[model samples]
Target: MRHVDPAGTGRAGAQAQPDDHPLPTPGTLPDTSVTDPAVNHHVNPRTDDLAVNPGTDPAVNPGANPGMNPERSSGTNSGVGRAVNPALNPAVDPDMNEVVGRDDLLLVTLDTLRYDVAAELAAQGRLPNLARHLPGGVWERRHAPGSFTYASHQAMFAGFLPTPATPGPHPRLFAARFAGSESTAAGTWVFDTPDLVGGLAKAGYHTACIGGVGFFNRRGALGSVLPGLFAESHWEPGFGVTSPTSFEEQVRRAEQVVAALPAGRRLFLFVNVSALHQPNWFHLPGATKEAGDSRETHAAALEYVDRHIGRLFAAASARRRCFAVVCSDHGTAYGDDGFTGHRIGHEAVWTVPYAHFFLDHGEPTT
Candidate 1:
């Protein structure tokens, strides 16, 4: 389903999602996304199958308990003997598999962060958190797959992050199956499922999502599309794209999930950081949340996001065998070339910051 670009563009764009709907608290996340007759609607804080807790944060702290059993992922429909399914077999010892150890993968998409803003922050050491992991990794500028969240993510989950400009051939770390590209590249992880979430599940990883922006809120039929790909998904009213404290709330929840994972389990964790998206004037000095977004405000927002990201990185770094990919979904217009918002063709909205690196491990390997 294609949606008209919120910023107004003549070209086709991503489908409109329930991001326009009133923000719903966690647990009470609207069921308007998509309803399968077979989908269970029961939700209880005590039940593991559909337990959801809403409005649990009063302050941002990364060490809080998740307050629930870590979600166990069942295998994708593909037929293969998976390594572990302890939820089904309580007697199975998780440590028996010595050959395969922790392979936790993390993807943090900085929603609506501009490339130039990031580069500026990195150079000034303002992003000292993510900067420590930048050595010998891919930090080049690239065009986003789409100008907005819903559109770009569809391409990203298909194993396309952002392609390098002036490129003859670009190497991909994770490759999704497509026609004619039947052969696998050396040292590259290959996925044959409909999307990366399914692919990771086939590889014996428990996948989860912590959403930030409205597009990811699981509000309407299209809203659930991305999060639905995971075994478990999380979102809250406080995690909205415009919320100043959304990233902090996300980190708190992420810390819970990370610590709750049973030993010897691999995690595929995905998050969308919404602080820099819009209504970002709150990040600027003397500017309130009610003010319009501006280049000055956007830069300040990135700094706010980076500070909390430091906390998140420290938490994830403590975990064993974790890998991370941090990038922006797309940039927004800051009155450049007379463009004030994203979606129309402009370099400000198209270019984004991208970095794929490993965490909790030693030096990154190619």
Candidate 2:
């Protein structure tokens, strides 16, 4: 299920080119000491900025309640199988407007994850971190815009994320200013630029992209397009499909990126998690080298991903309240209907898991 390296190297774990621009030095970055919740009582300057903008309505800016009291969560928690109340906790609410413009944004594409597998793993307590954080403690079944990474991500950056399985004209969480967009609602953060990255940057966000799959590896012109949209982009062999610890490395890098941002700068962090894509047999317990990838290994990869993703959520939230969109770009076929992979129309390939939630400030970094 790995994409051929755009650099023509054919290696899934190709070395990435160095970033064109280096990150700011520690002294140049805004003081991030307010990450401590105890001293975070001061109002967020970004909230006031959005509020004063005549173009931004209060409904479009949800900074009024930047931090929702998780203690007020009506959901029951039993460690591995917790039920989250979307109404009480802004984090699990499907309403994107609840925290979008007001909070730092985190978009994580769980590459190649299928909806059925994600749901079943959460139910079985195999994806405990996700089960504990996802809205209603479940993955929302949706249809991917494209059957593969490159096409799907292109659409996502243009504000065409996976649509709900139920219907059309679904209000998008974010949108670019286009004349005939039916999905753009009153609450949608309509940006003047063509792509979300540019629009967010124009709106004062320090956009960053953490690459995982080949399309984002920056190995060639085609591979560089997506990541290039952001103000800062990063990739390497450890963050690619072949690495067993891709998600951990991505999270570690993400934490550093967040820590280095100016205190008042809003962050728009996008991470493409590649561990669940393919060559996932190693995630299974005592799996032999000859074992082929199957639905079993796919679920195991997701479980491994769930174990490490919590640190990412914690890091983003510790800096500021964050609105996160976590989902799969598309699913892969494991010999279903005689199909072995994606890029063709198939039930397994089109159906992916999706969810959006808030990360309250000062949450545990683990």
Pick by TM-score: which candidate is best?
2
lDDT of 1: 0.62
Q: Compared with the true structure, what per-residue lDDT tens digits does model 1 show for residues 107-226?
A: 899998889888888888777667777653225688898998988998889877776655534444455644334222222345667777666665556566888887777667687677
TM for candidate 2 is 0.75
* Pairs of residues clashing in candidate 1: 33-220, 33-221
lDDT of 2: 0.71
TM-score of each: 0.70, 0.75
All candidates' lDDT scores? 0.62, 0.71
Clashes of each: 2, 1
- Candidate 2 per-residue lDDT, tens place, 15-46, comes to 22345225668779632111112211111222
Model 2 Cα RMSD, 1 decimal: 12.8
